[model samples]
Target: MFKKVLIANRGEIALRVHRACKEMGISTVAIHSTADSNAMHVRMADESVCIGPPPAAQSYLSVPNIIAACEITGAEAIHPGYGFLSENANFVQIVQDHGIAFIGPTAEHIRLMGDKITAKDTMRKLGVPCVPGSDGAVPTLDEARKVAAEIGYPVIVKATAGGGGRGMKLARTEADIEAAFQTARAEAKAAFGNDEVYLEKYLDAPRHIEIQVFGDGRGKAVHLGERDCSLQRRHQKVLEEAPSPVIDAKTRARIGEICADAVARIDYAGAGTIEFLYEKGEFYFIEMNTRLQVEHPVTEAIYDVDLVQEQIRVAAGLPMSFTQRDLVPSGHAIECRINAESLPDFRPSPGRINTYYAPGGLGVRMDSAIYGGYAIPPYYDSLIGKLIVHARNRELALARLRRALSELVVDGVATTTPLFHALLDEPDIQAGRYDIHWLEGFLAREES
Candidate 1:
């Protein structure tokens, strides 16, 4: 086990890692930017260092600064919670070269799954079902037309290196193919600096379901369960739930085993998630996240496991403490991302918080770094916290989340709390009958 660990990120996730380390009898060093000099995580850490200015590239994303901080504090490992350098292959390689452990998967796996086209090919080869389309990059409009004809229309073009809904386009007819293809290529080049694009048959109303898998790096792996992240806005997940209301025991067991088998086959280590789009009892591979996800709390709440601690143990060359038989979800869990953004418009709301109070009650867990007086900087993501609740069943879980959201208060800045409140009242959301596009359509209806 590592004696001391350095956290190379900020906000709620950084605090989450710190708490995990403390519980494991490990000391933590918090690296922050000048903007976060008075952040909550820094105050709670055993050691704190200011790496650079408020800009993320110069601070949280600066590899040299992170390395310098780890060296100065003598941290044996670096825990990059979620974003920044967490899944960066180069960062992992550099940290490993310096004899410092990275609490994540191997760099080779990261590189392999980082590109969308390569990831799809690999998953297909592993017997993981994928949307039928071009085997590789389209390369030409003529080739894309042929693929469209073979796979049927309504195909989507996606950037190999893109995410967050960027560098993607849909062509529903033959006439739209050329324009869509060219636009996707241009957007891909502008966003990822790589014009490489691929096509896949676009499912109209697929649910975004992802399976969580953990590997010991030695050929052993297990799947915890699935997370229903279909509640999304502009392709970004807004809310997540565990033990998806749609999946049955048989489907769950089959998909979980497939994901675990794939992870073990690749010798993957630590925490990873294999995302899929499910529709009409069919699952199609979407992508893979090689690091901890923002919605991990819901899974933990239902599974009763500390994923961060498990990740650390895996990094230390320890086998997973539990077998597949021991991993069974007991209840329902829901997570609401509390972002510093206004409702309807969804504009960023970053300012000094005059009043802040998080909800607390049975089965309620709030993970946040912002306080009453903290000034939220506009340099990063708008997410300020996550509100998670667990119960014996999905109905009770939804009721708990509603109560918790009502009790929560954050004044002096707009937030997405109102949006969640509205969602809780929707018939589709109440019945768990939503897809990846449902939330967007609902929001659009509200605007109209």
Candidate 2:
């Protein structure tokens, strides 16, 4: 067990990790930016350090400042929580170099899974089903056309280095492929500093499902079921749920084995997620997230596992007591990302929260650091909190989710709460019969 741990991120996740360390009888050192000087995570940790000013470049994302804080505190390990340096391989290596452990996957595994193309290839090599695409980058327009032709049109040109749906274009025909290929390549270079691109047969109307995996830096790994991250906008997940309504028993079991095998093949450690695209009774691997996820709470809720604690134990080189048999989804759980933004326009809405209230009960869980008079910072992510709920069935879970959301009240600033309100009311959503683009299209129809 670690004597002390440093949290290298802020907000609810930081607070979550701090709580886990406390339970394990480990001390916590929180590193915060000037903008988060009064954040809840800071107030909760055993000790806090101000790394830099408001901007992330000088604070949260700054490797030197964070490592310096760890050195000063004599913290034995670091829990990145999520975002920021959570997925940065170099940061993990730096922590290891400083004689401190990174409470996640090894630096090698992180680097291997960081690149979208390489990760996909590795997954395929491990016998995990992957979206049929080029093995490497499509550097030329002719190569893009050839790949698209092989994949049989309606293919997507995607940036090889990074993907947020920014440098992607759909080509349905020969003429479309040439023009779209040029644009996707140019945009890929501008967005990711890499003009490399790849082609894949676009699976329209697919449900985005991901398997949450935990491993002990060895060959031992198991999955905590799957999360339906189908509700997305601009390739960003807005709502997620565990025990996906779309995947069945056989499919889920197969996916779990595939994910465990994928990570084990890479000799991955700690917690990670293998994202998949499911369409027309088939699943295709998209990529892997080499860090803890914001939607991890849904898996925790149903599986009855504390992912942060597991991450810490794994970092200490402890063997996992839980196995494939131990992972049993007890109930349905859902998470809605309450972001500081507006609908239809997706603009940032940062202002002082004049009033705030969070829901609580048998199954409602809210992960947040904001309170009354807390100003939503313009320098960070827009997510203010997550409203998670669990129940015996999806219908009951949805009802509970609605009640929790209804009980949530934050005044003085516009929020995307209304979006969830409208989303939960949709029949398709309640019936769990929608695809990834379902919510956005539902919103569009309402606007029309």
TM-score for candidate 1, residues paired by index: 0.99
Q: Report the C-alpha displacement of residue 300, candidate 2, in angstroms.
A: 0.6
Q: What TM-score would each prediction reach against the true structure?
A: 0.99, 0.97
lDDT tens digits by residue: candidate 2, 23-93 = 99999999999889889899999999999999999999999999899989999999999888998888999
Model 1 worst lDDT run, 10 consecutive residues: 124-133
lDDT of each: 0.94, 0.88
Residue-level error in angstroms, candidate 1, position 330: 0.9
lDDT of 1 by residue, 206-299 (tens): 9999999999988999998999999998899999999999999899999999999998999999999999999999999999999999999988
Model 2 segments beyond 4 Å from truth?
Answer: none
